[model samples]
Target: MELINQTRASLIDYVCAQIATFFPDGADTKAAITRNFAEAMGRVEKCFGAIRPWPAGKFNYLQSAQYCLFLYYLANTIWRNDDDSGTATRLFLLNKTLNGIDLFYEIQMPDIFVLGHSSGIVLAKATYGNYLVLHQHCTVGRNYEVAPVLGEGVVMYPGSSVIGRCRVGDHSVISIGTQVVNRDTPGNCTIYQGDGGELAVRPAGRNLIEEIFRV
Candidate 1:
């Protein structure tokens, strides 16, 4: 529902801007604008079916609507994540580059945090697990050559990476500037290898979302 609301607001913004030219008025054009908005949403629904990572014989529009919106917003949310700060709830925020498909109007991201974008980030795979977090310049490729199976509460910090046939266990952290290729991590572990050496992995800060979105 959180992601749904976020994406809904995004849809309003997108559609409003689109029709601003033709229906720029107080109440005179409100009805017409509303109609246009509905049509736009339907188009987005179609694109959602195409871009989603999984393939199905049919789609549940309502469920897909909820999911598609998250992907749409994540692709455009810059870099953001809802941090838990040692809490049991694991939430994710993200940007546009973390999708396995070329997003047109629909791009569904994993409901996890993606710290940085606009630095050549790309997700070309489909077998990712839940609670996966990512940073700038990371790439999850296609096929089992390097498919990542992230565990619960996995974090990928700045310049960190997990590429190709990697399965990280629960509560594992990939530290800054580290590149993991064809490897597996155990639960409750910190995988860091940077210029600063390996920093201790902690439950992410509380204001991580606001930090990423700068909202």
Candidate 2:
């Protein structure tokens, strides 16, 4: 993949600088970053290449959404491969500080996903699937320690939420501003808040995931 305005060494330095600036604790990040940087970028490439909105095989560090995903992959790579919790924590904090997104590094995200806007988005530790797309002010969180399980090709629009023991089926579209709490949806459905604030479901009519991803 083409890394716009970043070579491997430059990107590593950039991340280390961000961590140091945000944390200012004098912790060593170079070793952990060096150990896991390539794997992390590989994951980023795979994800970015799959998304249709993003130009395939190219990564732009100036883009907030792409940078957010990069930070997540970097943190996750270090955590999983090097068992470097301190560095991983710093990366997570840096991402939150810069992007206003609360995506913990430990959360097991799928290999291919898209974030329309990272601001005001919170993704909890839950079962996720490939080709998931999340927009601004969207949330997939837990209720009383119970999180929602999302299937393949799920799309959560802006201001939409799926909280607490919800089973969102494959190709399901959670409409804008809809709140799905403690409910289940069938595959290929669109979830919305009906009249009187009740949950409603209807066929999505089109495959949004197919359009967004190179599936």
lDDT of each: 0.45, 0.93
Q: Local error of candidate 1 at 33, Å?
A: 14
List runs of model 1 lying over 4 Å from the truth.
1-109, 112-119, 142-146, 194-215
- Candidate 2 overall Cα lDDT vs. reference? 0.93
In the range 150-199, model 2's lDDT, one tens digit per residue, is: 99999999999999999999999999999999989997989889998798
Per-residue accuracy of model 1 over 1-215 as CA lDDT, tens digit each: 12243354465454345334433443232333333444434433443333334232233323533333443443233222222121101001221222332332222344443333334455654454444556556665544544577765566676666777777777676776677677777667776663543334344334332333212
lDDT for 6 in candidate 1 is 35
lDDT of 2 at 104: 93
Residue pairs clashing, model 2: none
- What is the overall TM-score of model 1 with all chains considered together? 0.44
**TM-score of every candidate relative to the true structure:** 0.44, 0.97
